[model samples]
Target: MPPFAYRRSAALLALAALLTACGGGSDDDDDVGPATPPGVRPVAGAEGRWDGRTSTGYDVLLTILDTGETWGLYHTGPIIHGAFHGTSGSSDGQLRGSAAMVDYDKGGQVHSSLYGGSYVPQRQLQAGFVFDVFNGSYVAAYERAVTTAALAGSYTGYAGGWPHPLTLTITPDGGLGLTPASTDCLVRGSIGPRPGGRAVYDMRASFTGPNCPLPHGASVAGIAVLDGPRLTITSVAPSLVDFFAFQGHR
Candidate 1:
């Protein structure tokens, strides 16, 4: 999806998750025994690294800790990076927080930005907007990940086009090979370690087959979350515009 589209989608997903979790019944309904008590349960699916791009092509990297704290880095162009810090709360299955950063100009002028958004746990999605006297928004999907050895197996899924089977072979040495049955794309990449037990991987493939829609080469970079027999991959680069999702079960 385009940056704007994903941002909107993330916002909607976050809102829906919040409404579903925090929604209350009408007065006509009986009181459900004073409602369930909210606790410091450390929200699920938000404590990880999320990488994405802003609508303006800025690279965004977000890291959420298990302690409800969040830190992020935003890259504007090649070598300009800014940092922000904030805290988050999980209530009724929803995660939300506000973060800020102070920037100094060449003459040491102070500038800051404030941002807040909702976390959609089901898709491990983080969607929110920034307030810097300028309106900006971002949407990023996350993956709960483990080690590479734990992910060794053959996965059959579809990417790019619906119903096109894509087979992946993940090796223990952080290397992988991909074969898409519907296209002649030769994909190869490595999976590197990220904080919090998650793996960050990138793939560069060239379309050598017939009738390929993509350019000669495209980059696929994202994180993977593995659970039992299932694996979920989130695209920070290609996004849904390149491929809807990469889902596979062992």
Candidate 2:
């Protein structure tokens, strides 16, 4: 259950069924309405291809300094080779948190991309995601995901009693971008490689933070593999899927 802190907590609660840039870490509810903020705590997911057998979900790249707060990078295909790397952030005293990169090949499939630094996507979902990367401060807890495959390029894992620094990047149109180490914070997305491998579209990301406050009905369902491969989009209101497997070579 330590797949790099559940791969940064289900990559932020099923990121819009696979990323739309923190698009409702748990579904921002139809333009923010219910107003459930105060001590929110939702983002808690971990499906690290449990090593049943099939998992070649490799190809990763993520980098974030101690400011970007959150970052991005993604990949899709039978990876699981060594399950990439692993880590998750949300200090008990550790610092900032999140993790990924696992494609051992058997049934390798898991792609994630993220980046938040616009100031905790509206107070970090009012604490639903909780925070404490030591002192950088935190208070949001919203995340998502479900599906993948690959063995492309890029990979990194360095969690040394941290404060920040999670990097990843995978392109080829599967565009997964996240850079922290100096900038401030940046997260990008675009991974739609379907057919036989999987991931038709996970996180086509389109974001806008800074003074974030536009939620209603609040919707952010989880589960996804994008579209074609295995566990297809499941929830997320009208669309937002799920389904994750590979350890057994599925």
In terms of lDDT, the poorest run of 10 residues in model 2 is 126-135
lDDT of 1: 0.44
User: Against the true structure, what is every candidate's RMSD?
Assistant: 14.2, 19.8
- Deviation in angstroms for 30 in model 1? 39
Q: Count steric clashes of candidate 2.
A: 112
lDDT tens readout by residue for model 1, 74-158: 4443222344456666644355565444221121112332334444453334444332211122212233233557667777764
Number of the top TM-score candidate: 1
- Winning candidate number (lDDT): 1
lDDT (10s digit) by residue, model 2, range 1-250? 2222234555466332322223122222111122333453432322111101112232222212222223222224322222222233432211233333322232333343332212232222211111111112221211222123341234343221122334445454455444432233343445543222211233342223331111222232222232111222211222211121111111
Quote each prediction's TM-score. 0.43, 0.19
- Superpose all Cα atoms of candidate 2 onto the true structure and report the RMSD in Å to 1 decimal: 19.8
